[model samples]
Target: MFGSFITMLTGIRILKNINKSLLGIIKYEKPIDKGIEIAGYDYDSVQDIFYSNMNAWQRNMGYSRLYDEASAPFGMIVDCEPIYFKYNNRIWLIELWKGQYDLNTGCEVGVYTAEKPILNLPEVYKYMFYNCASDEDRLTISLSLKKNGKTLFALDDKHWWLAGFKLGEYSEPSELVMYLNITLKDEEMCSSFVEAIKKIGYEENKEFIVNGNTVGLTFDKPHTTQPITRTEQTDKIIQMKNKLLCDKYNDITRVYSNLTDKINAIQKQAPEIYSEIVDKAVLRKYLRSMKNTETE
Candidate 1:
């Protein structure tokens, strides 16, 4: 009976271990099987599946690795979902996945049609050009204008600079009347910028409508340099002499006041020592006489 009881416990333990193993297998099953053709090409790994759908340009632009890695999976199983967005009067789908397989890890995004037999879809050329124009230091400035509820055109960062002008925008309503402002430090730079814009068919202070908003370009010219006449030069010289004399007099008065304060402090802190330097009665009489003269 003792031997039978031990054999029964051993059988129970074996069953429990088998149950745990099966549960783990079901929990961590690979979502995509090996040799699946989700991207129109057979892929054994998630990255392979993602890259197979990307075109040469997208691959070269490094869109495959542009995803948040902290949320990536650690094991073989991956979570994939489709994101739908409308652009240019057409609906598009993006398949995004996150997981790890062997040494490969992180998330990836790929564009495809929403229908079955998924084929790779390319991003809009204008969006792609503007978005990818940024560098490590300088971000590309872009303006998107829509006319009659449709995209008219987009101006990227290099466009204004190439036209030999720097543009700035204002948020205040008063300044917003001149929507795009071209401000240069000197008159020469302003003139050159004006010429450059005129070459491109843009007129100064011309009003146009963009996206139902009245848009206009305004130029801010620097203050002009003026020549000084002989009389003005003489007046400026006299003003400078007066200012210097006043400044010197003020400095001397400040020094005298500071010395008087120090002497008074010394007299209070060490009266006996101060008495050896000068007679207190004589000092007070002299200060009083000077004060009377100043009042007169």
Candidate 2:
């Protein structure tokens, strides 16, 4: 009974509304030349996507989860080479550089991180996701270094996540496990949610996630030219209709505002003309009265 109680107190508990975004898991190394293929993922699986993210993040500044918006392909962030954004605030998040390679080895090196870009991104993401001030989740990693025959590469870890996480698929693994406890608030917010999924289990070499409840990308990552639910075309039509309506509304509003501004400017710049128009109308009324008396 005592042991059971302790296990309840100490067991792994994931947070409520456990978003994949708030959790970032990186698996990296001295990069496999972008030529070495990962069995489960893609060629760009380990490289091309970071460039995509850098481009998107540059344009949007950040995304809004409240609107179900994410930078379209989120997994690409994983392909980034391990780098620390230069600033302390940016340190928490990972970056994808446009360039890398060792000058000494001529191994086609990867890109290095720029200082300012690094500084802004971490804070930008932290602000966007880690909104509350409560104690954040942190991971402690344990990895062992090995060599494969004559090849001087780190073994057991096929890859790593960020500067903090290391994972290997073909090679042996230096395992990583996280230690976290649910806060009182986290527990309160998710009691029923917790009850529904208490039976959920974690598997070994099974591609576990940084967030406790979710599963890692094991053998079955999907690829599609479009969304999974194609039958929702009708619903999507409705949504499109709504969006067009909103856009039209916004356009009309902008036109109205611009016209109002022009009118205000005309009034301000030509007050004399406005007064003359009003005065002429009054003078015409007097002339009509005089003409009526003469005709009578």
TM-score of every model versus the real structure: 0.17, 0.17
lDDT of 1 by residue, 54-127 (tens): 22222223221111111111111223333333333333333333322211222223332222212324343111
TM-score of 1: 0.17
Query: lDDT by residue for model 2 over 223-287, one digit each (tens)?
Result: 11122122244334433433443333333334433423422333355543332222222221121
Off by over 4 Å in 1: 1-75, 114-296
